[model samples]
Target: MQWRNSSRNYGLTSILLHWGVALTVVGLFALGLWMRGLNYYSQWYRTAPDIHKSVGLILLAVMVLRLVWRWLSPPPAALPTHTPLVRLASTAGHLTLYAGLFVVMLSGYLISTADGRPISVFGWFEVPALVTGIPRQEDLAGDVHFYAAWALVILAALHALAAFKHHFIDRDDTLRRMFGRAKY
Candidate 1:
């Protein structure tokens, strides 16, 4: 299928970044759920919490890169005769997902920093604190982060269902275009 945004199908860089972010997001979701089941005070939970923090920071970094890539590359064209309402909904949903991702990551960082913990990026290095030491603020940030994560999960499920609809029911090129393939 002809790309909607650019003339060519997505380049190698775009495809790689798309799939990489997808995998990371799925992994993060699993990790988040697992951490919720653990006792925060236990040693097992200690490492898991740190892993969560580190991976989250990494996701934040990657997301920033992804945004830049999206801006520069754009996405494939929408299906022909797509209604204005459908187009608007598509734009709104994508914007919400990106915004939610940023807010969730930022809240996590703020919560950890306020708790007097250094944010580590994948165990490689530490991120400087966005803000330090305020118990009330930390508590508030933690609450926002937790709820935002759940919102993301719900948004993702809807996004996936939409993609499936396009791929299966509509028998369209929406999914394939992103994967660098032309519609059959």
Candidate 2:
């Protein structure tokens, strides 16, 4: 597969990043939910959160890279079979996804660093707490993080359903394009 996007199809890079980000986000969300149930005496109590934070930090970096890649190699235009309402909804949905991702990540960061401590990513590096000091920062950010994460995941599910609708119902290449198998 080609490494750069074309006007008619997604390239290998876009395909990989798309799937990578999707899988990572879903995995992180699951991890977060499971870890929440761990009690103080659980063996995974500390380890689970450490893994979550490290992966979350890495995901933030990957998201930045994904945005830059989108800027560098624009995606193909919407398929002609889509109606004007579909096109507008697609655009709005994409923007909401991006916005939701950032909000969730940012709130996670705030909650992690509310005590003014840096986040250690797999002990390889630390993301310094640069924006602490808000009153009840952790509580407030935790609420935001929880709600935003749910919203992001739900929207992503809807996005996938729409793609399936396009492929199975509309019989279009919309889903195949992300898989790098569309007729460009």
Candidate 3:
């Protein structure tokens, strides 16, 4: 497949980034939820958070790259079968998804770095905490991270449902395009 987006199809890079970010978000959310139940004696109690933070930092890098890639190679236009409302909703949904991802990531960063410690990403490098010292920063950022994660998951589910509707009910290529298939 092509490596850059075209007017009618998503290229390999876009598809890879889309799935990578989506899967990582869901995985990190699940890990975060599971980590909350661990007690002080649990073997994974400390390990899990370290893993979560590491993966989160990597995700942040990928997100930044994805944004740059998107700017360099914009996505294809909405399918012709999409109505005006559908097109608008599609745009809004995409924007909201991007915003929500960043919010969740940023809050996660704040929660991790509130103690003025750097986050180590899989032992590769450390991201030093550049912002700290606000009272109750950790607690507030934890709440934001928790709520934003849930909101992002719910919106993602809706996104999947919309793609299903376009594929199964509407019989359109909306879903296929992300796989680098195009109706055009």
| Predicted structure with the largest lDDT when compared to the true one | 2
Model 1 lDDT at residue 100: 89
Q: Is candidate 1 or 3 superior in lDDT? A: 3
Residues 17-135, candidate 3, lDDT per residue (tens digit)? 99999899999999999999999999999899999999988898899999999999999888877999999998999899999999999999999899999998878889999889889
lDDT (Cα atoms) of all candidates against the true structure? 0.79, 0.94, 0.93
Q: Estimated TM-score per prediction?
A: 0.87, 0.98, 0.97
lDDT for model 1: 0.79
Which residue pairs in candidate 2 collide? none
- Winner on TM-score between 1 and 3 is 3
Q: Count the backbone clashes (under 3 Å) in each candidate.
A: 4, 0, 0
Cα deviation in Å at residue 144, candidate 1? Answer: 0.8
lDDT of 1 by residue, 81-177 (tens): 4568878998999899899889989998898898566777667899988687565988899899889988987998898898888889878777776
Q: Deviation in angstroms for 62 in model 1?
A: 0.6
